[model samples]
Target: MTVKVFLATATVALGLMAVPAFAEEAPAPAVTPANAAAPPSAADLLFEQPQMRNAAPGSTITYDYLRRSGIAKGPFGAPLQDTVTLKVEKPTVAEKGGAGTPSADARDIAVTMFSGLNRVPAGPFEDMTGNPIVSLFFENHLRALAKVLEANPRYLKLAIRRGLRERAAVTPVKVKVGDREVDGWQVVTRPFAGDPMTERMRGLDDLTYTVVTSPAVPGEIVSMEAASRSKDGGELLQEKLNYDPKAG
Candidate 1:
């Protein structure tokens, strides 16, 4: 597939950037320059890491999914619980990514994000590269949240981009994978808190996003959650996804 088409898909998926990575325009690996920078931030690990490259080709990774949007005085309804899967299929043919190619993370791997007839947009992305699940999660989350709040998507996107880049906190942690505990990292950020347009959120302003990643996991991502509740803890809206070891 052409690099152009892959980038187009990325634009629709996350529509935001910290390191310009929804695995977009990923380039080939290069050496570290002498005048290097400090250690990577949570944003860099979460966004720029070649998460997909860690997956074994021909393997399948699964996640337990939950998306609930029920704010008593809001516009959403009940939650949907399902299982989401991503299969790491090898490149069956040559991909024209010599020059002008975006990020090469998983450039040789293709993924199938869903297992059934889901309403989420399906790309002609069969030939596209990068981590499809990451793109899918952001696309679905931002679009739905915007609709639920009746707020502009750009505003929300900006808040997230800014939060991750400037205020996100990253900490080392451990996660369970079967009977064993594995090292992992947690990245947490509250993009909507103290937002200038708080009132427009109708109480979703404290939305917090937490992501966990472990190298031991097939897809690198162990879990992700985006949630917010009302002041009195009455209304609630939460979206979460966790890796399913049994399904691996």
Candidate 2:
């Protein structure tokens, strides 16, 4: 199916978050295709020093977000605010799938998310929940960041297949988190070449996602933001990273 169709299906599927619980497994890391005509060099794929993978198991990053629906400011509206914590865990085994090679030594880290004090399950949805769209958004965002940090080109292709792209330009940006000001690269990825409706349905028009990574630590995503608006151009969702500190 086309990326637009896949994104629409994804949004619908995400609406049901209360799916059946199954055994949790480590997420697979991205890898390059063996038969590609041309491939990136090891240096091109490797993350610089102080990578996200270097974080100790207990390190945590927190973000604060707000969701609003309906008119920007009027009756029949739904607005909510919450916090999500991403905790780093020890390396785990990588999932199967990739160039027929054993993934034995591949780096697979487990990063779990918590909404308030409730643990969010890993993997796709199976049932309905309150705000599955937002949850799934963060999950995919972080997972994609993880793969990119590991220098996997396949991850970019996977994102394209899922309706995201790698054509976004990297721009210099400054962001404030808590009391500190961070200088990083703002990488924005849009849908593949297509009609505007596809972009809108995928929330690309309503929301602009920017991944911020410090140049000092190339692949580490220091912060991210999603600014969204309603169909009628009203405010909808606001998500921003609040704090990210190394585990002491």
- lDDT to native, each model: 0.61, 0.37
lDDT of 2 at 226: 54
Against the true structure, candidate 1 reaches a TM-score of 0.75
- Writing each residue's lDDT as its tens digit, candidate 1 over 1-248 gives 32221112111111110111011111111112122234358656666666766667668777777766545433444456666677666554445554443434443443344456544543424433345566567667878887776666776777777777788877776676666777777778997788777766766778898877777777678887887766665436667777777775
Q: Give the TM-score of candidate 2.
A: 0.46
Q: Report the error of model 2 at residue 44, Å.
A: 8.3
Report lDDT (Cα) of residue 183, candidate 2: 56
Cα-lDDT of candidate 1? 0.61
**Estimated TM-score for each candidate:** 0.75, 0.46
